[model samples]
Target: MVVSLKEAKLYLRIDSDEEDTLITSFILTAEEICEEILRFPLSEFEEVPKLVKQALLYCIANMYEKREGSYYYMKNEGGGMAETIGIMKIILGNLRKESW
Candidate 1:
């Protein structure tokens, strides 16, 4: 994945081992989302790009901060989480341009 468990924990300032598994899941989920937005598997690249790594870190951090937030993204949705997800998409979309 783009971000390691250790890196993620450090990034998130989480020192406890209790959330290690959760953080790992978030890392994986962020990588999957990045791949989806990039239109290809990250494994296809010989070396993953720095921008992609940064994007994944941002995605993982977002999820960690809003662990209890809702995942509903409706037309009338009006919250920072929804908009934050949209911004993540935009960031990956730009990466898609350079990747393709």
Candidate 2:
């Protein structure tokens, strides 16, 4: 995993382990979304950029805080950050490798 559970928890300021599983899922989801946005799997990169990691934390935080509502990743139904699509278009897009 590019971002560890501990790291994600720290970013979310999560003090309890009760939601570890959920957080883990979020990490995985965020990783995949980020990869898609960058058009590259994280494993292919020799070194993951700090911005991409930070964006992962942003994604996790968004999901954890807004778990009550219906989450729309790409659509601006709720309205928030422009990169809400995955918190990747801006952050991860800059790092996009276009490996095709």
Candidate 3:
């Protein structure tokens, strides 16, 4: 996994192993989502960029934080999930490949 359990824990501000399993699940889910969005497997890249890793962290944190909720929204920004999606787009934009 590109985002280590330790990293995920730190990002999630988790200090105990109580939720290790749950955090690992979130990390896996985030990685899958990122790979789907990028249209490529993360394992295919030997040297993933820092931004890509950060994006994964953000995704994992978001998922972990919102697990209890039936629905999610960013009320402060008035953009809901668009802000997150936009950030992901910007992070992956340069790495996107065009098919002719």
lDDT for 35 (candidate 1):
82
Error of 3 at 29 (Å): 0.8
lDDT of 1 at 93: 73
Which ten residues in a row are the worst by lDDT in model 3? 72-81
Q: Order the candidate numbers by lDDT, best to worst.
A: 1, 2, 3
Q: Which tens-of-lDDT digit does each residue in 18-61 have in candidate 1?
A: 99888999999988878877878898888888878888888888
lDDT of 2 by residue, 70-95 (tens): 55743546534343654457666667
Q: Looking at candidate 3, what is the lDDT of residue 55?
A: 89
lDDT of 3 by residue, 21-99 (tens): 9988988887877776787888889898898899898878777766664444444333334565577778888876562
lDDT of each: 0.78, 0.78, 0.77
- Spell out the clash pairs found in candidate 2: none
On lDDT, the stronger of 2 and 3 is 2
TM-score to native of every candidate shown: 0.78, 0.81, 0.80
Q: Show model 3 residue runs off by greater than 4 Å.
A: 70-83
> Candidates ranked by TM-score, best first?
2, 3, 1
Q: What does candidate 2 score in Cα RMSD to the true structure?
A: 3.3
Q: RMSD of model 1, in Å?
A: 3.7
